[model samples]
Target: PLGYIKSISFICYPFAYGNPNKPKKMSELEKRQIEKGDLSCLINNQQDANILYKRIIKLYHQRDMVYLVKPKTLRYWLKSIALRDANEVFRDLVNSGY
Candidate 1:
């Protein structure tokens, strides 16, 4: 349907739209760090984790292709490690009242 096609197009178009001031691509290390951050926050259920995951995925690959895996695998991983780390940091932050 036209709506579906447009939805796909909307999702797909950003990789081609570059900001002139920004570099065309990020280094692999930078990308990995980003994914690590997302994983941490997602595990913790941090407020920004979903947004971070979406951005990190977008930075590295297309959204549609990323979903070929069984659903919820990434969520499980996030909960396992990243979430725990995020919770510890958040708890420290709150306890410190910073």
Candidate 2:
């Protein structure tokens, strides 16, 4: 009763208000939108993009109070940062979970 409610709330609350740094859980419609989302327009190919998205979702499920920073956010992280290719970030994601 109370324990069940507590357990359920623990899972549901975070699902509702996920970590601010990561992408929020997609509704069925949003998932479809992402599945059909312009892969070429984003980073890397569909497969790599999907893998990184899955990793973000996994992080959302596994950790508490963790923040995720996107590759683009490096601008804010370091104003002097320079990169030759943006896809390198997603490539790293494929090679390493981050």
Candidate 3:
């Protein structure tokens, strides 16, 4: 169907139409920190923890991947996602956590 095709296109090509909302690119340091998501790396402050948590969740969502694992496993998963994917990251992890 036309709608189905359009949906697939939207997933594959986020800007299928005239929309010009290209995601902001993350810096190398920022990307690394996001992928790590290590609580230990986080500072002992609510702002730091909140920021890291949000990044990890956002990364997972943007990659269309779900990390249903423990803390260590999640770190591993996020690290891998960070190294591999180069797609523009967007926030889709809202209300799920973080």
Candidate 4:
């Protein structure tokens, strides 16, 4: 049956592609791969740098369109970016002797 709208009751929702709210089930190998990608990015390994970015794009329809990246790969990409930023901050703090 098609979804219907009630006369008095209404449901307001955000438009999202795929199952964004689904819980991700990551294998030990996948987890390690993501971490490895993060490390590689930190080390300036551009070859495997986009591994996580590709994965995240898979998770969402928007991302997988152009590059067709896997959700798992995209996640690693994101992790790497966050780690890179955090590392910079840490370095700055250390330099300041904080």
Candidate 5:
């Protein structure tokens, strides 16, 4: 029982408090694409955008402590950030003729 509790806590504690050392899932190419402002790799179409929007929400819900305290507020905050970032990326794509 003690071991089980330890293991569960180990898995859950990171979600309660952000993990600074968490490994990023992004590949090198993806990193490069983001840095270059070419988000085609991340969002190629409306479907991709929709999927990514959901993923972003899920990611924040799982990893952000603020989300645990206030789910609605976190959702709104994340939506605003996503919209701003998406607009910037879309502008870059348009300017680059993509």
Candidate 6:
């Protein structure tokens, strides 16, 4: 019974166990892309995506009492914040363009 329950939990929350097959090192170019406002570079695997999803949900609940704003809105807000904090060249370009 315990083993069965554990298997079910694993199936439901695989990301909690972390991904063993993910690469241990990222190239310098990848790091630079992430720093330059590429949000997708932040999530290298399913575990990272799950972790980010949970964090977004937690932040949404903490910041609002009513279910007015969608989680996607929070995601864009986070992306904008990250982009603004990126290198001066990227920030200046984004600011001037938008």
- The whole-model lDDT of each prediction reads 0.32, 0.31, 0.32, 0.33, 0.33, 0.28
Q: Rank the candidates by TM-score, best first.
A: 5, 4, 2, 1, 3, 6
**Candidate 1 vs 5: which has more lDDT:** 5
lDDT, candidate 3, 41-85, per-residue tens: 232234653453322222242433332222333453465765443
Better of 1 and 4 by lDDT: 4
Q: What residue runs in model 6 are displaced by over 4 Å at the alpha carbon? A: 1-23, 38-98
For residues 27-79, write the lDDT of model 4, one tens digit per residue.
45644444345432332323464653211221222321111122223343466
Cα shift from native, residue 71, model 3 (Å)? 10
Candidate 4 deviant stretches above 4 angstroms: 1-77
Instruction: TM-score each candidate.
Output: 0.21, 0.22, 0.21, 0.22, 0.24, 0.18
Candidate 1 regions off by >4 Å?
A: 1-79
**Which ten-residue region of model 5 has the weakest summed lDDT?**
1-10
Kindly provide the TM-score of model 6 when superposed on the true structure, using C-alpha atoms.
0.18
- As for model 2, its CA RMSD to the true structure in angstroms is 15.8
Error of 2 at 32 (Å): 0.4
Q: lDDT tens digits, residues 1-98, model 6?
A: 01110111111101111244542343456334334543332222246534543221111111111111122334534667545433433444457562
Flag the better candidate by TM-score, 4 or 6: 4
Q: Report the Cα lDDT for residue 52, model 3.
A: 39
User: Model 6 clash pairs?
Assistant: none
Ranking 1 against 4 by TM-score, winner: 4
How good is model 3 by TM-score?
A: 0.21
Compared to the true structure, candidate 1 yields what TM-score?
0.21
Q: Model 5: residues >4 Å from true position, as ranges? A: 1-77
Q: Tens digits of per-residue lDDT for model 5 on 27-87?
A: 4563343345433333223455345332221223233221111112344347686576457
On TM-score, the stronger of 1 and 6 is: 1
